[model samples]
Target: MEVSKNAYYLVNDVLRAAKLYKLPSLAQLCRERLFSASPSSLFGGGVEALAGLEEIAEQDEKFSDKNSEDDPHKQVEIPGGSARTLNDDMKFALSDEVWADTVLIAEGHRIPVHRCMLVARSEYFRAVLAFRRSSTHLTTEAQVSNAMAVVNVEDSYAGIVRVLRFIYYDQVVLPSLNRKDAKGDSDGVEQEAERAEGAVNDYLAEEASDQLLEDLVAADKYRLERMKRLCEHAICVTVANCLEVLAVAELVHAAHLKQVAMRFVQTHLAQITAREEEFRRFQKDFPPLLEELYASLRDASREEFLLRIVH
Candidate 1:
């Protein structure tokens, strides 16, 4: 299908979900489609657009002063008439052991982070930092030049840690619940324990799904756009958990995830809410969604019945 604006935004999410599922073919398709589109697709495709912009700058009469050393106007004008500059990844390579300019206290757990990186990464953080500038947030031990600021983040310790990790590393590996120490490998000294390992794997899968839902909420709260998409994509693929995921999406105002979940429920209501126990779980957690899905299923069945009667 031709890539539309909606598809353009979903490219990264699709690629991330594909990678998580080990679908190299799908990942390649996403990459190809992304590159096929104009370089302006996502933040100017980061680096690919740089070369083209440089060429444009060189050809322009505006940048004709080659002999001049300091041409302050030696800038490339992009489509929006804004000067093209690098994305500014904002690397923090401070040498001091306690060189952080911001201390975030999430659930009373303090974490040191660079002010510049936080401001550069998130609009919410930028505002928070800006507000802290004139406030009494700086601690005595913190270097005055650094202008340290402390802010309390209201979230679970684990959830806050995951958000901060995503901010700093651009990724957060979810906690692994697959490893079960209860059973060890075999050597005739111990029976293989295949059943135990399979159960453990299943547990891990569920754990990962639940963690993604949680990460989605935290990402939304902090305005981590890409991370939010990644979490949503992870949860969206699991139709079985769509009810709970949908709940989280609605709470976080995740438009894409909410759409994906609603579509999943509408298209595969019976298959998704199959088992009585499973349906009850969804009913308990998200009664309104379960009711909506049931109504849709009933309406669809009615239509099918009416069609058969007419035929």
Candidate 2:
């Protein structure tokens, strides 16, 4: 289970692959090795390693100091300056109606947005606007341009808003889940008192999972590749959402995400199959995906058996 010092750089890449491949033991070992290994080991020993660590620490301190500043309107001072202020400004602009030239309607909810921002942030929006202008009559160009443009989008209000927020801030802002308080007392009454609270916590988790799925779908439709990958990472971390994410991945043709979810299912197949109700629903909705999962499981079993026999 021990990773060699020479293989430190490979540990992180191997960890990610191991997790995706459903090798929990290997992933855990890598995780422990990564956290336990010193910077000196990672960079190699001697004064050079010490100098590099100091340099990294100094850079991190400067970055932190810059972020801790209270100025929200600090202009970009250099090429690719820190974007905390810019992200804040863009988020403010997203809510400001005075300068917005376009309104995006999602699920009957009108969202005011700057055309320039959308065009700058999303290629899909840029192409859509370009097509509109090209197809419009020249006589009505001035009149149409002067008037506010309204575009109807066929996505849930929350989903569209999540995508818009990502476009504006370049961050995925997931809803915060409140942690349930742990009771010290082991009495039945104390445990009974927290049963309702536990239920509420479960509900919040489910809500967050649904929002993640929605964000994934929206990210895919809008062709936001980074956001899509982020959403997939978020979804893949939660085993409870694996089935749903797998279905969505199939629908969206997200090959990597589908593979990750398939592996998760394979790793936890016994527990997943134990939940007859949920498993049945997933099978009913995604029969092809279920078949693929079983095929992968069979292939994996065959490989494992052959390896054992060879050993």
Candidate 3:
């Protein structure tokens, strides 16, 4: 006979939708759904405590300047004033005692509140908890298998955490790229370039050649722009040193690293054009790869793909 505010709002929404859609059955279904539902309440004690702490911290920061100026010589005197210590000074200066108390209370009560809230509204936080559980499980499995000792991949827990957070919440957390220390005058450009090249060389040294190539392929597939660029630069440098390796890698990486390989081919087109005989010979050696490329082009949309035979 009596409906709560939430139920009344739901019923009103259903009626409004029904009038627009001209579906009376939809409204009836909504009412049946509401009447059959049981409501559960959650205590927001931990959240409230945290909110209060934050409010205290904000207030402290706001009034800190005025308080400091008003009492320059006023030191917080501890009981049995042997000497007011650094901890006492900081505690008094920051005025964080109240905030700390709030945090401690929140920490004590958080687990139970979170558990209750999670049970009540599991749908909202299900994906988050699932991701956290998956990450913890993966780490445990990796440890059991001695993955860290065996796998020689770059172990960036921070990077993985950031990527996971992004996937879970659609948020990016990229590091700043501005290298002011590395930049300088025109003559410094060569030194900077050499330093950059050396850094890449060092990174490659840490990783296996085949593994680096796989990472590049994965980066391209995932559309990781910075990583893709790094891989392209690495491949280009490798190709520059050993043209023969490029010719071989072109075939091996044709499928997964098509975009990068295509760009590499285009970059070295001038050299190939100059050595017409060698160009033909190289093409003959990888006839299968060329055919595959042509097939890919054919399958691609007409507007997107071009069939130009560049000599």
Candidate 4:
């Protein structure tokens, strides 16, 4: 159970060799053992803390022996492939030409994506792709995988990829989305000449702080509740993004995030007020929030004055 790193890779190396040496049967056995012994360490964490379930209802012994030898394949209509937890398979799936089904154009980069994944996770995409049922809708220049869909997006490639990661894994690895957020900037967005473009790391933007606001917008538009909460958690109080958070939260209709942003503004009111540019931006864009801040301060002052008089 507590295998050292050296032992771990040594087993993996043997398994690889077995397969290469025309011994898949040996490789398969070793692979199963490797999977059972601390799968999290092997997969780089985020696997369930443990595997298998005992409390799961046992099938009545009456139904345990249901295999048929007369016919080999059951339900041939179902898509056949190795049973995979693609949630952890990004590097392979994103890179493998065969798996990608959609093209996401972002920040001058054309990102290849899986259509099945987008449809399953995003309601916006479901509608977008469903509408393009007619073959006449696809554009000539469109680069499509599985002849599925194409989408254009204005956000940074990094930001959009973060969103895609969320959709593929939920909160476990990434949280995906649904619907209007699916059909953004509808021009050249999807293959109609396309269906369209695409949550995230621990509010994980590998680069700019603005990723929070971008994620919030995508979450709100795509109706991703968990992603919204994650963004809210990442939208911390800081001088740089304080006002930006408030404005963007309002624009995205994030009432709770708006309240949180407002509280930060109020707590830092003295400092925020001293900054004329920030204060004017808030005054112009969020007049109501500015008024609420003033009103709260006045009430606090009045209460303090009353306490002094009583003393």
Which candidate leads the pack in TM-score?
2
Residue-by-residue lDDT tens digits, candidate 1, 28-128: 78878867877555335567566644544354323235313344443323446542222222223322226677788877777777887788778788888
Q: Weakest 10 consecutive residues, lDDT, candidate 4?
A: 53-62
Which 10-residue window in model 1 sums to the lowest lDDT?
Answer: 83-92
Could you tally the backbone clashes for each prediction? 0, 0, 0, 21
Model 2 deviation from the true structure expressed as Cα RMSD, one decimal place: 16.2
lDDT minimum window of 10 residues, candidate 2: 74-83
Off by over 4 Å in 4: 1-86, 134-146, 171-208, 296-311
TM-score of 2: 0.67
- Model 2, 1-311: lDDT tens digits are 12444576577667655544445556668879777868676566688667755765575456446644744533333335432356666778888999888999988889999888788878888888778777766677577676677888999888888899889888996767877576646688677768867887878888888888888888888888889888877763355677888899898877888888888888998888887888899989888888899999999999999999999
Q: How does candidate 1 score on lDDT?
A: 0.68
Task: Tell me the TM-score of model 3.
Answer: 0.25
Tens digits of lDDT, candidate 4, 221-291: 66667787888776655665678887787787788887787777767877877888877877897788677
- Candidate 2 local accuracy as lDDT? 0.77
What pairs collide in candidate 1? none
Tell me each candidate's RMSD, in Å, in order: 15.5, 16.2, 19.3, 18.2
What candidate 3 gets wrong by more than 4 Å, as runs, is 1-159, 171-176, 181-257, 271-311
**Candidate 3 lDDT by residue in tens digits, 60-148:** 45555554566574344337845444444433523323322111122122111122223233332344444444565455654533322
Comparison by TM-score, 1 against 3, better one: 1
Model 4 accuracy (lDDT, Cα): 0.63
Ranking by lDDT: 2, 1, 4, 3
Which has the higher lDDT value, candidate number 2 or candidate number 4?
A: 2
